[model samples]
Target: MDLDRFTRQSETEWRVAPFGKMRVPAVIYATEDLIRDMDDKVFEQITNVAMLRGIQKAAFAMPDAHWGYGFPIGGVAAFDPDEGGVISAGGVGFDISCGMRSLHTGLTPDAIERHKSELADALYRSVPAGLGSTGKIHLDPLEMDAMLEGGARWAIERGYGRAEDLERIEEGGRMAGAEPGNVSDKAKKRQRKEMGTLGSGNHYLEVQRVTRILDQTSAAGFGLHEGDTLITIHCGSRGLGHQIGTEFLKKMAIAAAESGIELPDRELACAPINSPIGVLYLGAMRAAINCALANRQIITHLVRAAFARIFPDARLDLLYDVSHNTCKLEEHWLDGARKKLFVHRKGATRAFGPGHPELPESLRPIGQPVLIGGSMGTASYVLVGTSEGMGLAFGSACHGAGRRMSRHKAYKTWMGRQVIDELAQRGILIRSPSSRGVAEEAPGAYKEVSGVVDATDEAGLARKVARLEPVICIKG
Candidate 1:
């Protein structure tokens, strides 16, 4: 936190030299105040990431970087498989491919204000939440396997969402090389009835209105405008992703031991890229990615159905859906050559620059939409990836306003009931099953999203396009 302890590269950037087995440097992008608020463990964890096998460049942390399970939540590191790179469960986190998706509503803020109460109640009733929640769709073993393989396409086939929606999602809603056989029965059981539900904790479906347009040109490209209504869904594959991560971490520890790979932290259990265990984990992780894609897609249909009930003429169009946690195989020109590398983005999002072939055609010129979800009762932002990101941090950016305090700490110090009432008084309608959760996710628990976005833009990770404020929030 002490700027004096780090080499001040810029007003919003700091560099820490290699220490304790680190193969490269660790760079953190944050303002002086932001860095001062950072948890000490983030620096330690990020430095450890630099020591990993086949690390091509420096280990970087975004402005929202915070202490997490293994890697710092906002950490980014790319490793070359050809150079004996390794995959760490800690690097991917438990919620594999957990991400945010935004949908545009063809209504103005005034239109939503007229029936806000009824709409909020309808949404709370329609969407399932809390721990152990289940929904109407229950999958059999065969169906589950197909769902894992098919991803969002499976849901569209089952009449959950429109077929055209797939194009707006990452990997077109399904990542290839997913092998359901690598997924355990226990994980399948956990996901059986979670389809079309908004699971608990930091996850929600919100009705929002665009409040500020930062870049009019890019905003037009993203179909966003001030006062236009939109919906943001934040959730993941539910218990299935957790089960898979838990099950694999145990296996990878043994694999790590057999390979004589010494990890700075036990939570960073990993295996070499060419190792049998690593291959299995990648296959299973890809399946979990599919699960998350399918889950969000089904939830999208539910949103459409809810809208149809109130406004028969209303149309909900997909903006973009991208994962925040996962390792991706992407080619980045490094050291004067195009090399395929395994880029691990734990609590980060891929901010592919303009002209990248993976971007949706409509967004090619503007670059990929990077949605940054805020904490409860705060504002989220829409940003676009910049080519500068490709050179600075492997096309990665912060996923959210990182928590300033842990959930446990927040619960112990704050009152959830008061937090909820205050937000409601401010015209933000919120519905949650647990008051404790409301306290844990109190807006004050996170860093200012504005600060995070500014740092991101200055750091060349992403450029702001629009800012959105919540009108209705269905908390998990």
Candidate 2:
């Protein structure tokens, strides 16, 4: 936060000197104004991440970077196992696979304006939300295992979504190496009836209209044009992912001490990547990723059904879905050789470049679609991955407009009722169980989304394509 103490790399980039015991220098990508607005603790936490073992390149922070449990919420880091890389629980936050999924609505905004209220009501009724909300599907232990291993595919098999949907989802809707046995019974119990439900806090189902086009070629490739309607779903693995991260952090601390791993911060407590504890955590984390994918998949079905009521011929086609959390074993060029690295992206989206074999066939020509959610009443962006992203960040980008103030601060400073009324006046319909919840996610509580996306594109993390403004917001 002290601009005078750091070296300026650009208008939106800065470098902190090598601090005590840091293996690599730390770099932060944020406008000078945004940097000054950040809490000082973010610098401390990012520096702590720089001290971690086997961390490759630099400890990087995105434009939306903000103070978090350990790593900054919008942090990106990759570790090499051959160099004694470690996997930290704090690297991946409580909301495992908390991600965004966008659906392409072929209709223009004019086509849906007449039925907006009807569609919003239908969506609010169809999708269960709010704190402790449960869905129609309640999975038993045996069935839950199938869901964990199957991911969205398991749901598609049961008629939740079409097979074509898998091609647009990250990892084809199923994360490899998910081990349901590693997840505890309590965590499983919490998620049993939570499938297809949108949990509370910064999560919502939004109806948006493409308001601007930045790249004609990319926009055309994505079937997006100004005035086109689209649906964006934001949520995660719900209570189960939090439980998994909570239970394992305690176990990892003990493992860290036993393994003689010296952590600069207790929150960075971790285990060797190949250790028994690490392997189990990875397996469990992947299972949670699947849970999130399955959760979003079912929600997609609900959104489609809700739209069908208003527009009889409406069919919601998957644009793209991506996960923001979890440590993955990926092959990247490191130290001039192709070595497998364990990439940990906490609050970061994987921005795979064009022609990457892993990308969905439809997206191969245009690159992966990076959905960056904005604060309520703000403009969200549709970006595509680039080769520059691969070189700069191992193909990673900011996930959202990061929190400017904590929820506790937002609740204390703003009136929930007033916030709801303010947004409603702007033609944004908000449906939530608690007025206080609305206050906690006030747009003022987040950084300007356009600024964040601008920094992201400048940093070569992703290329901007289109901008989306919410027409109706269904909150939890």
Candidate 3:
């Protein structure tokens, strides 16, 4: 976190010149205050990522960067397969495809305020949350493999959501190249009953109200209006993703050793992209991505059902769904040529700029909606990806108001009951199975979200669109 360690390129950009086995320079995008508050480990981890073989451009950290396993959370790096590129399970984190999905309620905050409590209770009962949470749908072995391969498309086929929803999801709601055979039996078992459930730790389903429109053009494009209500789901692949990461990290470590790939840190265990182990990991990882997409799709169905019980006219339309975790093969302009690379984004969102072929036609003019979630009782923002961001860090932006304190420290500092009461006073209802979980996810435990968003915008990563405040939150 020492300012002297980096050369300031601008107020929102800092660079660490390549040194000590580094294949490229390291960059961090954050305001001075944000950077100063970051843990020193962020510097070390990002620099270590730069040392990895086949790393292109720089290992970059977002404004919300924080200490994490192997690469820093909010880290962005790309590797070239033809140049001995490697895939690190650690770079993707345990929560594969952990992401955000927002839905339009077509109702104003004033309209929902009267029934907020009833709506909150209905959603809490309908959507399972917290540790080891399970949903009504249970997948058998065969069905599980089908879900792994089909993703949200499978969920829709099973009557979970509408087909139109896929257009708003990344990869058309189904990540291709998923080899379910590579996913272990144990991992599938852990997720069998977990589909549609919000797993513990930083995951939640919130009813938010749009309070500010930062960019009128973008807000209109995203169908946002001040006072409009929105439901945002923040969760991931549940136990299955964690199981895959745990199983593969150890295997990758052995593979890294066997392949004689020198690692700057043991946690940075990786294998060449073309290696047998890497192929297996990628297959399993893609399956996990599908698992997450399917899970969210099911949750969306449950949310709509819950809303039906409260407001029969509510139309919970999908706005956008994007994942922050995963190593994806993407095409980017490198050295004036379009090249294919594997981009790893851990706690970072892909902010595709305007006119990208991958984006939905309706949204292409404005750009991808970069949904940034804040801790419970805090304000979240909607931003649009900038064309300039493509060249900056492979079109990536911060995932959220990154954690500033560990869960242990947070729990020790505040009682869950007290935190709940405080949020209640602010009119932000908190519903969770565990009081301890509430304490662990206190809003104060994270960096100021507005500051992080400002830095991201200033750095040309993403442009702010709308800001949302929580009306109710069902936490996990």
Best-performing candidate as measured by lDDT: 3
Candidate 3 backbone clash number: 0
Give residue 163's error in model 2 in angstroms: 0.2
**Pairs of residues at least 3 apart in sequence or in different chains that clash in candidate 1:** none
Clashes of 1: 0
Evaluate model 2: give its lDDT.
0.89
Compare candidates 1 and 2 on TM-score and give the better one. 1
What is the TM-score of each predicted model, taking all chains together?
Answer: 0.98, 0.97, 0.99
Q: lDDT for every model?
A: 0.89, 0.89, 0.95
lDDT of 1 at 177: 90
Better of 1 and 3 by TM-score: 3
The TM-score that candidate 2 achieves is 0.97
Model 1, span 1-476: residue lDDT tens: 55666888988779988877988888998888889988888887888888888887888899999998779999998888888898888889999989999999989887899989988988888888887668899999999999899999998999988887988999988899999999999999888888878888889999999999999999999989999999999988788899999998998887777768888887889888778888989988999999999999988888888888887787798999999999989999887888899999999999999999998788898899999999889999999999988888899889999888889899998898899889999999989999998899999998889999999988889999999999999998
> Model 2: clashing residue pairs?
none
| TM-score of model 3 vs. true structure | 0.99
Q: What residue runs in model 3 are displaced by over 4 Å at the alpha carbon?
A: none
Off by over 4 Å in 2: none
**Candidate 1 has what TM-score?**
0.98
